[model samples]
Target: MAEWVERVDEQDEVLAVVDRAEAIRRRWLHRVATIVCRDRAGRILVHRRPDNMSRFAGQFNWMLGGATEAGESYEEAAARELSEELGVRGQPRFVLKFRCAGVVSPYWMGLHEVVVEDQVRPDPSEVAWHAWLTERELADLVRHEAFIPDAREAYDRYWATAANSKRP
Candidate 1:
């Protein structure tokens, strides 16, 4: 049997627990969080989801992230996902929040980015392939439709903010 996480409604008043399969099948508007980890060399890590994934299978996305557990803060969930999926231990800084709307699953996604210097050992079950690319290269991939649309926006926003803050 698949596990189900308890989630609160958008209004933050009603609580409900739905199985993962039901959540996807019912097109529930749930909350999912992701983190973008970059290296000091200005390279960002990207991962390809397993082809068997139910949604967005074989698509390239950020290195590590997933849904936020009930009662879990966004930062806490991001940090936990980074360590759980990528095997990298570090604190992630919150960047922005975005939404991904699909025919079945509409999600409000929390975006976080972090800088790390350690090696990443991604979970084979969650990530099929991984790589690091410069911002320009990432943008090119986005242009070529090599990345998830939501991820592309997250990367662009993050890079834009970082660039603007570096100016004198």
Candidate 2:
């Protein structure tokens, strides 16, 4: 069965629904939601994508999320992805959403944050491994250019937003 995803425009206005593969193959602008889980230490949780996957295979992902289903909002999608992928559930704090061309295709990506205290049992098919890292530690790894491009953008944008908010 072909997975379907919602296609949106630059302004996030819904245009139509399309097959996920065709959307990627044609570089259609689509909606994606990412969930960034953090522990008490402020360490971000990262997951390694299985090598056999289609997009960013074998690379570590900064967020846990996927495309928005036909009628779902970004927030709903993020929460659902979190539960489905990591075996956890919570209301995530939405950080940002931006339209960008990335490793998969051009997408309007929504970045979300979830501070969790429960066990995370990642879906073995989607995540091969997982780890928690501080900002500096993640930065070191990121310098090696191993992240999915759009995720890197979201991370940078999240930090930039955080930094700006801290201004006194």
Candidate 3:
């Protein structure tokens, strides 16, 4: 079955519903909702994509999420993606949203954060490897490893916002 997504405008208003593949082919803006998972110790969960898949296959990512299906809000998409990718559930708190000038396709990215206390059962087709890492370790990997481009942008923005929140 063909996957569907809402093509969105610069203001993030919906333009139309289209097939995901067509949206990619046309470089139409859409919504992709993601969640950054952290453990109780404040370590972030990172994962490597399987080598066999397309679009940034074999790259590392700190966020787990995907295209928002038609009529799905960003929060709903984030929650669904969390369950689909990690087999763990939690209420994802909204963090930020931005337009990602993607390597594959441009889209508005809605980012959320969740603390996962349950054991993560990763879907092998989506995650080849998974680990919990300190902020320092993840930052080091971001500097040295092959990471997904759009997610790297989100990571930087996520932390920037986090740092800003600490200001007086």
Candidate 4:
């Protein structure tokens, strides 16, 4: 079954509903949710997109999430994605939302983070490989272009914020 997505304007106003494929093909601004899950050990969980994925195939990305469907809010989408893709449930802290000109399609992405002790069981179809990485290790992936491009943008902001918080 094909999935539907919410289309939005530059101001993030509801524009219309569209099939996910059509939206991607046209590079429309659609609602997407992304997560950065951290384990108690201070390591971040990262996963590789399946090789058969239409966009960013085989690229490593942070956490788990999917697009917000018609009439669903970003939080709802994030929570649902966590349950579906990671098999864990908890309130993820809202980080930020912004527009990204992604390689496949431009998107209005809502990013969140959660600290969890639950063992992550990433869905095989969505994630080909999963591992825990230190902040330095993750930063290396960004530098080497091993990470997904759009997600790299978000990670930059996330790391910047984290760095600031550590300032005395």
Candidate 5:
């Protein structure tokens, strides 16, 4: 089955609906929704992708997400991804968005934040390994581990935005 996605312009205005592979192959802009999952104690949920996956295989990522379906809002996509990938559901709060100079392909990434207080049943195909880590530990892994490039960029941007918002 083909994964269809909306190919958009720099501002993320839809130009056409195309296959995800074609969009990636052409480096066409598309929208991806991602969620930063955290526990009540504020530990981030980090997962490693399965080696069998086509993109970013065996890479670590702090966000659980995928390309948004045609006409789907970022919030909807984030919610769907949370359920599909981690068997957990909660209202994902919109945090930030930016155009990523992607390692694989360029795309508009909408980053959301959600707290998972329930037990997570990760799908093995989507997540090969999972752990909740402190912010300092996650920063260490991001600096030293084989994390996904796009996600690393997003993580930096997310924290940058958070820091800016906390200023007087």
Candidate 6:
């Protein structure tokens, strides 16, 4: 089983330490990633995490991503997750980072984006459903609290930066 590490609440300046294995087994202090993909129409791809997931099960979320391995770079972790969870190959662009505080399981999240033309084959164990949505649609979902809270800020950041960039 993978081990977990005690996470520092950087914003709150709180310090605590716990057994890594116990933390993960107990669903505490997880590290995760968010993958953002867009089509020619400028619609973003989102997916629902499998209900079997330990936290936020069945939650509508961004594309293929997950926890980072020990000593793995965030970029490498993102790429691996993109291929593993979505069965697609492409380089991922690092975009944003956020922390979600939980009573028992705080999460540190990394966000990445990639543009691709290949079809997606989501891993059933990881993803339950997926959809393509425009920025406006995503914003509406955020307004209604339909998406994962930890990912909303990253999504918004991606949307803003993507809109400003000249690259399609």
Question: What are the candidates' C-alpha RMSDs?
Answer: 2.7, 1.6, 1.4, 1.8, 1.5, 4.1
Write down the TM-score for model 6: 0.74
lDDT of 2: 0.86
TM-score: the better of candidates 2 and 4: 2
The TM-score of predicted model 2 comes to 0.94
Instruction: Give one clash count per candidate, in the order shown.
Output: 0, 0, 0, 0, 0, 1
- Whole-model lDDT per candidate: 0.75, 0.86, 0.92, 0.85, 0.93, 0.70
For model 1, name the residue pairs that clash: none
Q: How much is the lDDT of residue 62 in candidate 2?
A: 74
lDDT per residue (tens digit) for residues 46-95 in model 4: 89999998778898987588889999998889888888888889788887
What is the TM-score of candidate 4?
A: 0.92
TM-score of each: 0.83, 0.94, 0.97, 0.92, 0.97, 0.74
Worst 10 residues of 3 by lDDT: 143-152
| Model 1 misplaced regions, further than 4 Å | 6-14, 156-168
lDDT of 2 by residue, 56-152 (tens): 8898777899988888988999999999999998999888888877876888988889898899999999999999998888887765666777777
User: Model 2, which residues run further than 4 Å from truth?
Assistant: none
lDDT value, candidate 6, whole model: 0.70
Candidate 6 Cα misplacement greater than 4 A, ranges: 3-21, 24-30, 102-104, 157-168
Segments of candidate 5 deviating more than 4 angstroms:
none
Predicted structure 3: lDDT: 0.92
Q: In model 6, what is the error at residue 107, expressed in angstroms?
A: 3.7
Q: How close is candidate 1 to the true structure, as a TM-score?
A: 0.83
